[model samples]
Target: MNTQTYMQKLELLAERSISSYSYIHSLLEELKPLLPFAGACCTNIDPYRLLSTGAVVAHNMESIHHQLLTYAYGQEGVHSYDNMTPSHTSVMTLHCATEGQPEQSSRYQDILQPAGFGDELRAALLYKGSCWGYLTLFRKQDQSLFSEQECQWMVEIAPIIAKHLRQFSLAIPFVNEVKLRSPEILMLSQQLELLSSNSDTHHWLDVLRQHEGITTSALPRSILTVASMALTDDTIFDQRLHTDCCSSSLPCSPIQVCVPVREHDYIDITAYALYSHTSSIQLMIAIQSASPLDILPWMMEDYHLSEREKQIVDQVIEGLSTRKIADILHLSPCAVEEHLQSIFAKTKTTSRRELIARLLSQTDCIISR
Candidate 1:
């Protein structure tokens, strides 16, 4: 193929590498005809495992020969050239791992030699900062040894195979671990859905407190923050009122809930300064065993969002006004206002300026055991 055509094919194959194992297997199959080798196989070493094999075109070799190659390479003890005994049949594996290139031996000298095999070339597969696996090729007596050009070609494609193997390792776990029918997360999701529609503030507070209790019971260390307004009408709010309630024992923090106004695309704000939703209008629950915000950095890194949205949120704790934000971002006043509206609704905040203050001040006291 032409250089440009080959590069284009490589690019397409790289994209397909991010997909499923079956797709990857198909890709390797397509690339096989271009090589001098009789067959190819890919293996993964992490967690010490072998992936699927690609289509191979072996000459006068039974499928058992290929199976034997896999068995020898797949074992934990067969990692290096020095460790392997110099057996004629298994010399290909040791040569590949040690030489960092394909190696060949006479079929007569190796077990395959007795079987009328003329030459064998083994290629080591390296990936993700470690040796992944190997691919072996065999030829009959009339066929020549693997040419230098063919070896170079195999080396060129080895890293691509490695890259795809690493990607496959990551993609598979994500697919397998996803909950296709998670009743618990689904039930919680359903409750959140109900909460999106419920307008009765008192009823919502009751449900919120019950939910908090249930969630907290499962945690080893838990802290709950409810809206101050929810507790203002209750006798418990006044009875427990003390200097320590907002400081020494129960630290007061504000939470803002921005509900979309019915008529326009604007949001209405509800601010709560208490941690317990049992008697509060808004609440922020902080499960104290781990910091939820610590997980945010990783989540943000994996997902894509507009630069403007990221900048606005990053500076939220700084208490910048929409006008000031507009000037800083070089955006129009109306555009800044629109961005702020989306931010408030998504974060369930009433005002952009108070977002940080509320997050810091809102604390749930964890009485140590």
Candidate 2:
């Protein structure tokens, strides 16, 4: 194995110099010479549903990618990750494997083997001691199994991977230009309108496959599948402020997504209802940035801002004027100004633009234990 090469790559990743598109795909290829895995996948899972919303999978296995989007998670209660621990496991050979048998499971027979993988190793991506993401490597059957020292090597690098990944996923960057004019209305504007109005899960899936891209009239099938997997039916029809109104506050906005095939690229997707249709929900994609408002709650708690102050901060980031914020929140203009002053002081920012820059420039991601 090339230890020197591995260390150099690790150092680069730690510096966050790796482009978003190559985050996992490029890293895995470098590690493969040492570990000798023919296939790999890196994933970001939603803690609530334990579903992978975004993933980077081996490009050669395009069909396998499809299965990944629809495949029921079989690793649950099967790996140390099920308990949200930082550990690595060889699906069939690990000593602590308590599940019936990894190789005998549906995931192996239906998904792994069909993709030409004979054995699988899952490495945990834990943050603050809980599994938030994962890295999986696959080897052909003719290859020898992974050794203990290699597994140890994986364990040693887990923290570095987790830290940078967290930064990458939550980054909205310190953009000189922060546009809030509302994302452009693309070809799916009509479908987005329909979904926003009703948010029927079935219709949402169909609409995903039909999104117009920069050049093409519709997105690629694989991209659509990735979007489908990321935008869960439940998350789409989430809690509504009113039955007739659009989706209420997302737990977090601009969901973090990893498109592995696209150079391990990361994108943040936010849904909005356009025009006059309150229920027509359309997805707005930020190619490599998080939504500025998504980072506000974390700042609010850190700076000890009150709920009213937090609301004002959110509106300010949304580019609303003091008068507009007051109107929307039903607070008097004087009260809104008072809250803004308190927020500015607490956040140590002199103006609305500075507040957004401070928050978006560097806010930690949430990773519950």
Candidate 3:
């Protein structure tokens, strides 16, 4: 098939009503003809933090995730996915980025070369001014390098993939009756190995696996992504201090990620460093269903609410009257009413009650101890 026809097929594929996993998995497979690669890593990124939230791997690339992430956030490596901007070229091959000298890339020297891989092409999946995920395709050592034409093709199709990823981010998954109200705590080694977890942890993990359609024994990609961020943050701290162990009483700062998992349901995952007396650093991860407050900002973003609209919506959710909200924001009651109407139009709700219900669906499932 011609390149233009392949591009059209990809656009059509993105429009299909499939789960996120299916869409991305099939996307990688379909790219083999136009952009041949022996391995690939496609990961959903937390748009705000620009950190990975989940990933899909092929050709045994799963084992290198920790190291790959390390180099991504490490001092070395150009064209890091996190550093990508809207103005920057979002798609580029290592050979091109390094001026045809791939040896100059730390990631190539440390991760790719060791894995017997050559010429990596990376793309930041962006749409609507927000990055939804990242794509990295790898060729074997004996394979030819990625050409400029191939990289340009990736740039053209990236937004389509990003749009699908964004749609999937807001799409509701199969709702399971079983729910864990309290947060489940998990301990992990610095390498992100699952060390232990609360009794309820496995139940929640099962739910995640079911939703992601992953049947493997490996730790869920979301959990690892969170853990990796925690480590990356600590690593940054350690760099300034010139020490591996944090001398302070407090553990490293934590990272909290909230992602939609099921119908009107979101999961909040919190990860932080745990320093034992032995000076060994472990990662502590807490997983629980997102509270109303936790999901509010995400809903606002999803609705594409303006700053004023977001403030008004926040007050509305807080059960404030129009006059009260107007007084607080120093806006006339008429202006506040007008903003409410706009919000209603955007959110597709008629009344304040309906708006709140739509913005903050009853996703919590709390049980008495």
Q: Please report the candidate that would top TM-score against the real structure.
A: 3
Error of 1 at 2 (Å): 6.1
TM per prediction? 0.35, 0.52, 0.82
Error of 2 at 313 (Å): 13
For candidate 1, write residues 50-110 as lDDT tens digits: 2222222234454344324323432223333213222312224333443532223222244
Sequence-dependent TM-score of model 1: 0.35
The local lDDT score (0 to 100) that residue 143 gets in candidate 1 is 66
| Model 1 ranges off by over 4 Å | 2-7, 17-20, 47-62, 66-111, 173-369
Question: In model 2, which runs have C-alpha deviations exceeding 4 angstroms?
Answer: 1-9, 13-18, 44-54, 72-100, 130-132, 170-173, 176-293, 297-369
Per-residue lDDT for 207 in model 1? 30
Count the clashes in each prediction. Answer: 16, 10, 0
What range of 10 consecutive residues in model 3 has the weakest lDDT sum?
Answer: 360-369
In order of lDDT, best first, we have 3, 2, 1
Q: Candidate 3 on 10-35: residue-level lDDT in tens?
A: 77777774667778888888888768
lDDT (CA) per prediction: 0.38, 0.51, 0.77
Error of 1 at 79 (Å): 11
Candidate with top lDDT is 3
Candidate 3 residue pairs that clash: none
